[model samples]
Target: MQKPEEAYSIRVIPDVKIVNKGILHTENKIEGEEYRSYIFLNFERITNKGYEASPTIRDDTLYYVNTKRNSLVMQKEFGQPEELFKLGKISKYTFHDKGILVIGEDKTDKKSPFVASKLKYRFDSRGLLRSRLSLYLFSHGELRKVVSGDFDVTDVATNGKRIIISATKEGDDYGLGDLYEVDVETGELKRITKGEGTVVAVAMNEKGEVAYLGHREGKTPWSTAKVILPELGITYQCGKTCGNHVLSDLFDGVKDRLIFEGDVIVSPGQEGGEAHLYLLSDGKSQKMTDGKIVVRSFDYKEGKLVYTYSTPEKPVVLYYEGQTYDPNPDVKGLSPQRVEVNGIEGWAIISGENNPTILFIHGGPHTAYGYAYFIEFQYFARNGYNVIYSNPRGSQGYGEEFAKACVGDWGGKDMNDLLLFVEEVKRKYNLKGKIGVTGGSYGGFMTNWLVTQTNVFSAAISERGISNLVSMCGTSDIGFWFNAVESGVTDPWTEESQMKLMRMSPIYYVKNVKTPTMLIHGEEDYRCPIEQSEQFFIALKMNGVDTILVRYQQDSHEHARRGKPKNMRDRLERKLEWFDKYLKK
Candidate 1:
């Protein structure tokens, strides 16, 4: 959708030190591309170098892990980043309120079981570290390493029971994950759930009781059970189907609201899987909102819930200095237009006042395309493409019932939703002759799926997508979990596996593809590893399909989206070029 004159165009946010950083924190990017390398934290006035994506702010201090440096640093007075500890040869340092913590094998003279360590520090009410404490490692040697320096901390939360710290880690197989809770004080560690396939999410109530989500294990795709203090001999179970839930967002600090470690559920597979907020009050659990909502953050003055919301239809707007600006302005220019496609309600975005549109497909067949801020979508809009993305059948923003509708169906009904959505957009926008499609992960799978099943779009780009369920079952980090849940397949390789998985796999229908397709992948990605791309690429080439494959060797499963600065820039450029070659009129 690039205008003839828009070629050789560059977008730079004027005077604003805002970087279009990826979602997860990692250093992976294509070489020699234009991108935002540094961004200044508006509140802390801290200028973060390299890729500083997710920031956790607490007590006026800001905490972030630099993937480029592979180190954790603290910044006070918005000064230079101070190195607190080197997790070198180990894993990256995770930031907590007191200090940075690392979890890994306790490698020392006395090797012990898995151990987690933290650096201690003294901080003021504003959250700037006043002094440093002995580096505390729960390892055997009994010797703690202390590094002296001031610290920067933020996004610190506590229910007067425990200090909760949020950070990310490189998973064994699924690239990097956004993790929470270092438990610096009580030495209690817990993983707050996000992404897909997470059965349970844990939180702490005011009484220090742990709340956890209890879902049916394995691939049976049962109901979800929200349990409060199940591990502490106290139990309150919300009896619901236990399908995989992805925590879309969270809110903390509600007056008289009891949130335990286990009282969280992403979107269950019943409705559209649209996320909703619930609270336990007066010994009764109550549903808060009825529509699709994602809790970005919470402001509690004396523990009263002020307001919380997320971007699903509109970009998140922030009021600053008596002025309002779209925090996700990349999506600011996009105008959300609604239309009914074959009796299915859907939405699409029109960029600016002109240009051909790119049909943006989201992953999670059960996930909904709501008002969320997506950088990729923004860039597509910035580059003069009307990027239209939606949450089809499996999307979470709808509700539990709609989300579950795609469970065993896979690409059947969901595929129809996308096709109908596109048809509706075309009719509404009078854009019948020009259209393009692209997505990653499940979205990627669908891109591949779409290219084979139909030639609706002029071009396609599939990133970290899947082609064959059989190979993906073994190659993916969560393939076992995915196969079991969606297809109810005990053995991915067996012919008797889910009929839909085989029928929907793009590789089975590659011969029907006529669109010029491009494949992008991260070499080390184990979740939806490079093998998925490779399988599709091989099939396309063998069938004489017009295809190209680009792989980022330095990245893993995450780097594809959240990799280095240079790589992100290159990816956008390449993607634009691919679409330009085919989609542009």
Candidate 2:
């Protein structure tokens, strides 16, 4: 659907101060289907066939890092596509102060079992990073550091003199993170802040002001602090005297002023909600947006402001003038037919006005696709194919019962609900019985599981998915806790339990998959790490199934959802490419 430019919608234009262009996206709460509500209303877009889109621009070019494969890809021209660089787990990069910071690790640790290392890079004017550094936990259980004298030429970030690095630390009691500033020319290290609490976000101002979110002096509450160089003086505190609360990095580096959002968190038994947005300048502040606007994103250019806002009754929209318009209004280029299967309601978002549909299975095993910002489904719909997304059994927000229905029956009832969704969408829409199913995380797991359970889908995209529950039981973030609940396992290693885990694992049943499949993962993701993708890809390829793997470096599970602007764009592009190659006509 094409929207008039004057229509209201929230968007991110190029910031005059940064000369960068990126879109601000949001995911809101879709009311009706509460079962899978957590996964609802995420704002995203599927970009050009292979052309990438990003939320931010860095260096001279836009760069996106895929953490699963451990690679960095750069978007060349404004309207052109991106190219990926394979660096493995050796280095990480970020754009700061018009310079690129490169952090390279020596090797994985044997003591704390280095899942990953903290890296920082500082670049010179010529776009060459002079200092490459790393933060590591030594065998002594103490955090250690390293610096590299080697100079490398990369286009990730090509500006700046001094670079501040952030790293997480593990100690005898608990874990925290540290921040360090390194001299690019000399490879000299200056420890900025360490110990106690983690530095969540960092922003450096033109006047050498470093603003960040951190906990100070073993304090219980997290606050935003603006610190000065040299003596490391703390000037401003957003939450210091306000009590226990977390401030947004959006408040950092606002220059002379701080935007204080009153009480971001809603305490237990609290009614309604409140937030305050303002511009802090010269130790004084002015209100920017009212607290009642229900804004998820806002960007100010010149004196005009563009933002997105919605109420419970209205779908998400952007604002301009006095009117609001939908950025993606049910893609007129395509047609989707609604369907209800086995008492479950759903619809197929088609690629074109007429074509077979791609059955988009949502994760949470209990989540549903409703009126929210989904660029992928819209992309497929606009491109002339049908895409179907549904909230199957075990999805959330459907009161607590429906959300918990699939809790213990991972591969059983939830899978059945999806299959029924597909059958009903096909029957209702006359979809020619051709469907391509895809999802990420839990959805990826389901896609992997789906191909094994049925040959219905012609193709599948399993993104950052799980294949082996037995292995994942020992690897994932909450594997230990959730695996027992799902598999009813008393001992993860026990033969009987292992067999059951295998039975439910999609990789084990790869021999039954007839549909071509693709696997995408982030190398740095702690949630559903690359191992799961690797195992699934290997199994499928070994079984002679058409399979491909795309891995992004330094990209955690949060990359696709929320990472650097460039990464977010590249993720959507790559995902669309996979679907374009397999699901599209």
Candidate 3:
């Protein structure tokens, strides 16, 4: 254990820009306190105002998205940022061999901002969808509007003349998107992919061949996601290894996930819990990175690869440059022992037999717990608690069908997997004073459900969790669609469907919660909504159970990750105090 004063301190690398001369990385120090960014020039720190967080290199020039100004800027060496395109809040800018592609909004469009006229307008972390993203092509110092309409484009890649994008409303609006090719000169859009489910990223080779990273038609939205080359009839979906990077990291040094060198494709793919850059050439793929490591982001040029990578035990030390740019070297904690019992893969940090145990469940019922550095989990391990976490059913990194395993089962098998994993860990470790459970989002829902199902856990904390399915459908931003697709609720308004939803809801069995529980939710959480926690807290009180509802204002569903620094520190302290009071005894 270490001093508590320096406990909530977090250091991260937000943007890592790779240039010809050297590597440019922005490091944020002292999280939740005074924020300071340090820019490095080839492993050495430098400062430049015009240089944005994540800048792209195009013909010895830099191009970046200025979110504050809502513009795309061009900057040469030792020059001020020149506004190239001032579209509404430019989120992404791509530099291809042919030209530059920018995506943002059209401020000239006369429409009420942040207001959606549809059933599913709002989303978690991303609030109301007031307007769709507008795509523009900046070629030869001239800006041209290429795409803006009913279709919401998720990802795009270009060859200057041909633009390949992924959008949901291109044809049969089943919320499933297709790969559409847009001819920039003619302003024509054509769908290329056939069996489409969900497309996360897209890429195009020099030969104008398009490839998408996603799954085909599946049982639900949480389908097996992979990179597919329809022309080559090649799908990069793997069961033994993760087809893409699915875990969250401390520093997401932005660069590129998909790289096309001629017909050869280099992409980030995860093996087990760690991610590696996989090169796919001649219709065959092989990993390029060595050792057990987690690559957050990477960029390549002139036969040299620059990356920001980390592990549970350490930080990113660029292998090519032979330099270490560790964000928090001094802030080290307990390491984990990877384990798998009954097909449920997980990690367990064993301090001692006397220490209590806390089972950490990941959100996304779709996201997996992998080889990423988590400060909260590290703190829990440092505070004399043996931590156990795993990717149960409906988790990514385990192929497509496995992710859809809990499509209609929700808390059924996933809950059982967690319970079973924890029991096995407890027995294998042979020492546990008390057991606690905690998670956010979907994990929060499981926390509430697990407590009600078994008395194995002495305390539990649910963050941004779901309790009532019937209310969530109408209240949450993505509730209507998420519930229908995830929970198999075809008709939510029907009495039969309502009964089925309630039967699967945690609030329906709140009376069965014997554990001392804590509900941590955001007042402005639009995904699960704050009402979920309030309802569960009220029911727990009515049943004479010890429960507390902690709410954070000015925060959405991402309170734990990207919330206010002070708020993040306060959250950690609150969880520690709650578990200490209930589980320490």
Question: Top TM-score: which candidate number?
Answer: 3
lDDT of each residue in 398-497, candidate 1, tens digit only: 4456657777677788888888888777767776446888887788988998888887788999987888877776656567556656775555566667
The C-alpha local distance difference test score for the whole of candidate 1 amounts to 0.51
- In model 3, the clashing pairs are 32-565, 224-400
lDDT of 2: 0.49
Candidate rank order under lDDT: 3, 1, 2
Per-candidate local distance difference test: 0.51, 0.49, 0.74
> In candidate 1, where is summed lDDT lowest over 10 consecutive residues?
248-257
The runs of at least 3 residues in candidate 1 whose Cα sits more than 4 Å from the true structure, single-residue gaps closed, are 1-200, 213-279, 283-294, 299-301, 304-331, 340-345, 351-355, 498-501
Model 1 root mean square deviation, Cα atoms: 10.2
Candidate 2 C-alpha lDDT tens digits along 1-585: 322111112232111112244333322221221101011012243232221212234544555443334444555555453444433243445454433354543333334522222221211111112232342212222223334333221111122444555544222012244555655544465666655654444444434445444445342211223222223444333211111111111111111211112212110000012122344334433444442222334444344455553222233455644555564354232333456677565656654434757777665453444433344555555555577777676653243355566765778888888887776666665666356788887889999998998887878888888899888876765454456555666676789888988888888888898888988887776667689999988888888998889887666765444344445456656656666676654
Listed per model in order, the count of residue pairs whose N, CA or C atoms clash below 3 Å is 68, 59, 2
Kindly state the number of residue pairs that clash in model 2. Answer: 59
TM-score for candidate 1, residues paired by index: 0.66
User: Worst 10-residue stretch by lDDT in candidate 3?
Assistant: 248-257
